[model samples]
Target: MSTFQAPKGTYDLIPPHSATYLAVRDAIAAPVRRAGYGYVETPGFENVELFARGVGESTDIVTKEMYAFETKGGDRLALRPEGTASVLRAALQAGLHKGGNLPVKLWYSGSYYRYERPQKGRYRHFSQVGAEAIGAEDPALDAELVILAHDAYRSLGLRGFRILLNSLGDAKCRPVYRAALQEFLRGLDLDEDTRHRIDVNPLRVLDDKRPAVRSQLADAPLFRDHLCEDCRAYHAQVRELLTAAGIAFEDDPTLVRGLDYYTRTTFEFVHDGLGSQSAVGGGGRYDGLSEMIGGPALPSVGWALGVDRTVLALEAEGITLELPASTDVYAVPLGEEARQVLFAQVTELRRAGVATDLAYGGKGLKNAMKSANRSGARLALVAGERDLAEGLVQLKDLTSGEQRPVALDALVDEVRKALD
Candidate 1:
């Protein structure tokens, strides 16, 4: 082995297994595309202040987990810890919100970095397929995002996952609840850092996972009880829309997403099969994020599904994705002349939309056939010097162990027919 390794908390997705990752991402993204969310991509890193302001400076993501650094030119940049801020920043900079239709819908998939202690389902470097609908405040948009996410998981055959729903009160009522929560938190016996979070973001205290913190929080004030009329109405409409769509969800009063900008509807998708890192993916409506990031008041809703964690959930559920073979035809060429002839035919087959692989390095018939079997190709194309002289090749059905001679000129058509 080489004396090198992927950085701690990161993984290399290689080979046959990587196919599953791609399939998962596609499954998650399909529904959003069907719903008219156009695809968007952005740089993996962005100006540090964008996240600090948009994702919340008080949250652990900015304060501790963000992989922040100063550039040689004195510009501070951070690898994106999440997708929303960068996506919104890009949308704002490109004036999509101003030029396009309201609720500029978008979908993105890529890696996000965080400097956290790694655990199962919680990697420092992870992949996500995300969707965003910017510039709309309709609760239908919120329900659409949630329904799309749920549909994605189900499409991947993921079961036993629950969508936890909550509404973090909007600007008018959140402060009142924050003060009451801080008052209760301050009177409890807590560590200094936990106490400090109370002042910086009292809502975060409710999300603490430790039993000690969670136990004390049992009596804490909830945002549902304090939501202003507008926020309450907004939350009710979102729930109604979800119910109308036949999407089931549990009301989670404690689901204060680890972001400060979530104004009304917030949600998390959890699976008990994932152990402590139970959250497979989660996101919520960040109606105030655009203004916080120096853009106009564009209300938006979105969600991100973890690609790696979804693969884990699939494994936990004993579900296997029915992935197609990487190669449809494996060509085993027998002599130098036959190799040259079959290589051209292989190229033609590939051009005809057949997934084809050729045996290289002049492997023997046995070894070449072995390689063909290993490739999971359905058919093996074999041509010896004698066969090439006869202007023909042998097409072997690897599955049924049947072989037949076909005209070399008609090879491409034969392979296409077999594959179809």
Candidate 2:
């Protein structure tokens, strides 16, 4: 027989460590909730074509990184490698866009999967806090999404992070820019794989992370150069609004998003702390994804922040989150009768919103006290034969090492006040 373990790419968030994870999640998602973005959850996996069409077949996620399997019923599904496609699919299926809400604001937090070479800040399974605003094309919406992500990072006590912004030019102008980039890339000294990218998605060639490839494409034609009057105007307006709102960003000429659906505004959050894997999260506007994935034309924009990467960034910056202790009281019972009565009292204390726990095994007084200490509880409630006979329970303050006898009828009140 062998001991079981969690899957290689997954992890079990346990004990005091899990408290920090939760705190990070809450801090990141608090603003989205406050801004009236209702919570929405989609399936962990969806039909494979949903991502294939929406994320682009040439991208790494749909071609190699996706975890796809066929069900017994002959449906091909894949664990979501990202959040936006699944969210958009759900919104379309539910007819949320058809009801004329104009812009349906939603926020979600959950795990996303990708089959990547595991390393620090890059896991096969990870978590993200994402938000989407569907059915609108206003640059203000783009600004709003960017600001929300900026606020989340700032709220988490993060410093030395830069927000990079770019406009990929919209439908009317992107095709022209693509043709110019393709022509320039074709004349370069490149490999067959890099050349193939020109035919499939020339814009992504600008996103190449390889040193050699980046060096070659440094002089590549700029998308901003070929932007039509309308697109150029829209991009200008988005920049103007961000400036007015005091959101600073750099205009990177070659900033092409990894996804195929993105159009117009694209952004990324980068931290200086992490050495190699520095991108904390990113997203952009996908104006035509709805129509591309068998739904009515819906223009939407959103972003997803990697919770794991953010935590690593926090660690890198020495920002320690002091999570509160798990327990306020530990009930230690000596005899069988005392255990039963103490169990009932523990239930009552919990029902009244107090964090309480109890010793499970029949342990000696010293051992029970040890368990109380290990629980991080500030106080302990002990009920023994002698104390019960006297119609009282012994209360011990673990911090002060002081003990007092409290009447049984007033135990809950006494404990509550002392805790306060």
TM-score versus the correct structure, for each prediction: 0.99, 0.96
Best by lDDT: 1
Q: What residue pairs clash in candidate 2, if any at all?
A: none
* Residue ranges of candidate 2 with Cα displaced over 4 Å: none
- For model 2, what is the C-alpha lDDT against the true structure? 0.89
Residue clash pairs of candidate 1: none
lDDT of 2 by residue, 1-420 (tens): 549987777777887778878988898788878877888899999999999999999998898899999999999999998888889888888988888778988999999888988888888999999999999999999988888888888888988789888889888888898889888999888889888989999877788788888889878898789988887888898899889989888887778878999999999999989988889989989999999899888889999998888989999899998777899999999999899888988998899888999998898789999999999999999999988999888999999999999988888899899899
Q: How many clashes in candidate 1?
A: 0
322 in model 2: Cα distance from truth in Å?
2.4
Reference-based lDDT, each prediction? 0.92, 0.89
Give RMSD (Å) of candidate 2 vs. truth. 1.7
> Tens-digit lDDT track for model 1 on 1-420?
979999999999999899999999999999999999999999999999999998899999999999999999999999999999999999998999877689899999999999999988889999999999999989999999999999999998887899999999888998888888888889998999998998889888887888988887777878889889999999999999999999999999989878888879999999999899889999999989998989999999999989998999999999999999999999999899988998999899888889999999989999999999999999999999889889999999999999999999888888888877
- lDDT of model 1 at position 50: 94
